[model samples]
Target: MTDTKQEADFLIHPENTFLYIWQLFMVALVLFSAISLPLYAVFAKDIPVLLIIIVFLFFCDIFINLRVAVKTKNGFCWETAEILKSYRKGFFIPDMIAALPWWLPVALLFKNEEPGIITRFLFLLPLIKILKIGHYLQVFEKSLTINPTIIRLIKFIVLVGIIAHWLASGWVLIGPVKEGLPADDFSKYIRALYWCITTIATVGYGDISPDLSQNHQIIYTMFSMILGVGIYGYVIGNVASLLANIDVAKANFMRRMEEINSFIKNKKIPLEIAQKILDYYNYLWETQQGGNDSQVMNELPQSLSIEVSMYLNKTIIQKVPFFTKMNEVFIREIIMQLEPLIFLPQDYIVRRGEFGDCMFFLSAGSVDVKGSNGELYATLGEGAFFGEMSLIRGEKRNAYIMAREYCDVYRLTKESFDELRRKYPDFDQQVIETVAERDAMNKKKTEKPAAPVKKQ
Candidate 1:
């Protein structure tokens, strides 16, 4: 079992770089044991160096499991006694015996004589490590940022590859080992692999058909064919599911677009207006990925939501001269109530003569300060605040505030701002000081004479 204990309590963090590296090393050792053990047991000759490593890792794994944090039914078991108890109750014995290099001992014991089927089964004992792969995958799933669906798909492929490798190894020891085998182990393994793939994928080709005369060989071939059919069906279903869910955001976006189109068609809306709506939706999909940011924040606990909202609007607050001098508590209280609004290109957030109950703070993209005849006075980018003077004084807007591009603007309602300001006496003085200068600047800009027309 992979332990994902609390970070403070962990002996080794699952996300630690060293832990992942160690896991990769262990997986490599398992693969080596899985392949070499069965193949070497047939000859029972010289001992390989990997057998030494496996024996060493077998002991190391015991200590690693005992110390590493383990999660349990209640939660992560941080107590040392409980950790040991969990390990003892889990795969400790089977993993211990399976991880042992039993084939090494058998090879040495029967050095002069070749081993039989019963003795060869000692090499296969290590196959249980293959089962513990599920445990290792849990660690990877936590540490790696890759999509789980992608991981599962890759895992399935690797699993099939390992199964084929195992079957190929066994195929070599099926009958008279020398009858139709290649000159070398590599070539022999390759031939066995080819037969396994062809046999399992489809009924084997005539060129590599199994001998019908041997009862065991026929039975083995039949099982492989049956297993192949099951594998084929399972892979197709799972792979299809994975591919469909790979782009969930896109899927949701399309569904929303379809519903919008249906409404547009039913209402007999003009093509130009419909196109603009579609463009607005496209911008929403790109920026928010077909989801409501407010709803997402609302789903989080109030404490977390407050921190996240404040963090996102932190820069905007710092940029506001009125807010910069205010205490963090006042800033945070106001920021939490700010609602996000997106404006598409050329869309007027507030027209030159429209009354508004809210002000906007630009968080991303840019907007234009325009007047009659679409005269652009200024292009405000991120951290720019506008529409406040109108809200504070309860007067009509002096100039058009239009989005120059897709803009993410956070709106603070007059009611919310008033509520927060009421609790702080200094807030009124700061607002009065800032809006006076802003009012003078706007009056000058809006009063400017019209541009000269070129004489033709």
Candidate 2:
């Protein structure tokens, strides 16, 4: 039953699932509809079924946009007045305009005659519908989970296609290829496309050269050459940068480890100690993504890192009684002061009677608390914290704590605690209240009668 409930919960991620479905649907709709427009124009008589399917898909796209606006916040406004306001000045206004072309054809249905000049021009609505690609690009950029490099690459590809289509349209409209060709409109566009690709790639094949005798054709050709150089350079630079980003951190870490290994050998360090060092390095590399946490944090702006840290540590820190009532800023400060730690199985984290200077927040795994005689007192798991009593009161640890398994924890030292208390008077009061409660609990435990031991 528990497994079933867990599975149900896993299936209940609402926003992310909706966004994923939305992205896929939009990509398919745009690609299919966009490609269909040119083909429909070329072979209008041959593929009546394809034209109907394209028309149906266009209407589906309009409804899809309406649904998106209704379901997604800041999509299209839900209120009538707000929807009008958004139509005037919102990100979705272009999408609304793109749908207008579909309605024009519908309006012509009332005339019941050969299409008018307006209706014929309305066939060009597919050009306006291309705006949806830009809308999707904006959406993809805002997504946190998607890689920015991939998003940039997608944008580049789409831009190149759009540019190529525009150039081909210009070429066909200017009559550079001549009207008497036996080939159809599709064949003409294909020839224009071939010229555009060669020009943009700077691979002037000379077989399909543009008609440079005409001034417009010469200007167009020159523009294509310049644009091609810029696009080619942009793609090369971005791909190189992305590859460098992928390799730099990993390569640097490997090189540093090699140097460390060579030093260990030169110093004749004990094999057991060297192995432990290597294990520690490996654990850090795996967990920290091959960089020092402090150094990484240092690179980010203080406010940005604080927000990120607060997001990660807020839930765990809230389990600490003293932090329960603290404000976000206070909690963020505490998170910034915390240091990460990892403990191996059976490792003694805190020994009984030792002066404790820090408290631990167990982020993962389990630990056992034992009394002075090594009898188990209690076991604590993830989100559980301990050592606060000693850290708060400047006293010796009352019990020994050891990791029952490999554990990850965050430690907050007394110095940071003291600084916080000094900065925030409210923190001092919370600390005092927590200390009193701990003292009272300890007194009750000391007063209780000892349990009788069972005979073996």
Candidate 3:
């Protein structure tokens, strides 16, 4: 059983380059254990060098597992006792099973007689080590946090293809040793692979058929037919599922884009307007995958949607002192009422003397605050807000705000603010105080010094 704390806690150390290097080494060792070890055993001779290489890899496997367990245990913030318990339950049993083959070779060194059935069976023990690949996959899933989709695809291929390759290669290596098995072109691996592919595809070309007389050969042929069908079904189904999931949304988005292009060409819309439309659509597609955020939010329960809204706008709302003073629940309610607005370069968001009924929070890009005569007063970027004073006081806008570039803002209507004020008396008091301070500042800016007139 996993500790409750360990299950909830995941330490993501992306800055640790050494950890990444270690993970890569683990992947290499897993591949060697799962794929290479079996291949080596197939053609292994009594060479001392081959023995040394096999033994070295076997020790490396043990060492890597130990190091990984220590790192993982530390990452989980495990105490000494907990680490010991986890090591016993998680690592010890599986590591022992994987380590079983390492001793088999050492035991065989004392044998003076010719190699027998026992020797061949000893070579087969490494197949048990392939179980470690599952553990490695779990580690990789937890440790690595970059390019997740590509990494997942690579894992899937390694998990499936390596196992299949091992089984096929093992069959080819073992088939010739059996009695009464005809050894022709069928013994060649290239020929065997061709046969396997044909069989798996259910397209037996009659070029390679098993001898029916020998029981072992018949059994082997039956196994191949069954295994081939299974492999084909599994591969085809997964590939189809992956394609269905990955491309359906993308294909629809492309079709919609093409339609927009055709419409623009036919209508001959102004270049500026067309480009703005394209930019808006591109931003929507990139950020939300061409889906409506409001529509998606409507599908969820109000409580859940509000929570999600709170999470999404947390940073922006925190930057605005107005929202920060309100309790989190009221803040969430305010966020839920906010709607997204986009502006292109040079677009006037609000002109001085225009009636103001909405405030804006800049989520992205920048805007220039200009005086009545179009003199630049100030510039505001992401996390800045404007127009709230006019909206609160039911007055005209104080300044002209123009988009310096393409901008994304969250608009909060006066209706929503009024509704909030009516619900929360304390929040209403705060808003009134804020409006007073803002009005005083504006008055100060507009007031002229009487002393200058006396000096003239």
Candidate 4:
């Protein structure tokens, strides 16, 4: 198995075991709670207290479940919200179930950080409100994923909510309809909410009014105007941002598709091979786009022309250490024969025992040169050449070369070397000189002895 696969398997095994234990514990808790609820109702004879305890326990269970869900990597906010809703319904169980708004619990859980005890308790109300809002947002996000059209619908809802709150608060202070209002009835709350919505939307019909006795018209008027402007701006800003993100995503997708098409056309790849290239291209594109692509072989296509051109340019630049002193035409010819090779991290570029048929010019990244002494002799980076000894002498590689990271190399094979040598007679002399200098350096390093120890 690949290293990634092994690591994934290791991570998953523990998670699965933990999930199983968690489920078992939850089942036990639920069964115990179910048994205790009725027993307490019958024996204790204090139904309200028993009911309160049961309700509190149910909420506690929900809190625990939500905590677990959020901690898990695959946690879905919607799922956690649903659990909270279910717990609330169960706790209230009978007539006119008095469940708090969903946002209350969510906001509490997602607070900025730990605060002073009193501050934390004070913030709890807002936190719960925000959590309920987040739950709706989570649902909206999921809806967008399934049907993007829902994004517009969600935006409209937010605008309506903002407008409603603004108008209701404003109308209660300024409008005539608010005068001589009954304080106790449900109609009072409905009218207040309605007026707030209208004022916030900036569609004041002048029907509602505040009592002249209150003399707080200016405060309500200022509050509504400010809130109206903020809400309107927020809605517009969010809508604009969402649209921009969608446009960017579409543009990127088109760009990748165009790249794939260009690759297929330029390479003249067969349909089957082209399909694989397209798949791989998509994989790399998604990786670049930040998504999963394991189910599809998202390997990027090797554009022969582009790869060859890049190899020529990089090889010529890298070979400057050797070729700057040589004829320009000869350097160009040598570069033309070189091919680009990609190696993943830790891949052996040149195994010690393998018969080396090519010399590699590093275009990018680093490689470790493992010597016979079982230690890394040196690390070679871009512009460095390796496996050249075998190319000059027609022998096996003297050292192993392992990639330190994903690398791109320009390789000149033995056949290409021989052809170049036959074409350019002077090349042999340069190769011999380069090899001799490297050998002399190696010999000196080996010959150098440890210094005599001073008597202590």
The lDDT leader among the candidates is 1
Residue-level lDDT tens digits of model 1 in 1-456: 344444444576435677788887777777777767767655444565655667678678777777666665665556778778888898788678875777666667777766656667776676677677787778768878877777888888888988888788778778334555566767777778888998878767856656788889989888888988888889777889988877777888898889999999999999999998998998888778788898899899988998998888888878877888998888878888888888888888889877878999999999889888788899999989988777888888889988889889899998988877788889988988888887798899889788999999
lDDT of 2 by residue, 1-456 (tens): 253652443321223566566666766766766655544443343324544554556566554443332234633233434434443564354455454545344444745554443443444565455666666656656666665665666666777887777667556555366556657777888888888888888898977765767887788888989998998898787867775555566778898899989989999999988987787778778777687766777899998889878877799999989989889889888899999888977789999988989999998889999999999999999889998878987899989999997788999999998899999999899989988887899899889687999999
Top-TM-score structure, candidate number: 1
**What are the per-residue Cα lDDT tens digits for candidate 3 across 336-435?**
8899888888899998898989999898999999998889999999888988877887899888999998898899999998999999998888877877
Q: List the residue pairs that clash in candidate 3.
A: none
Segments in model 1 whose C-alpha atoms lie over 4 Å from true places: 1-10, 13-17, 31-44, 71-78, 112-120, 175-181, 432-456
What TM-score fits each model?
0.85, 0.57, 0.64, 0.33
Candidate 4 lDDT, 19-125, residue by residue in tens: 44544554444444333432332223222343444345445434444433222356433344554565465432321121222223433565554323333233222
On a 0 to 100 scale, what is the lDDT of residue 176 in model 2? 68
Candidate 3: C-alpha lDDT: 0.69
Q: What number of backbone clashes does candidate 3 have, counting pairs of residues 3 or more apart or in separate chains?
A: 0
How many clashes does the backbone of model 4 have? 33
Model 1 lDDT-worst window of ten: 1-10
Q: For model 1, what is the error of residue 177's alpha carbon versus the real structure, in angstroms, after optimal superposition?
A: 6.1
**How accurate locally is residue 352 in candidate 2, as Cα lDDT from 0 to 100?**
90
Per-model CA lDDT versus the true structure? 0.79, 0.72, 0.69, 0.57
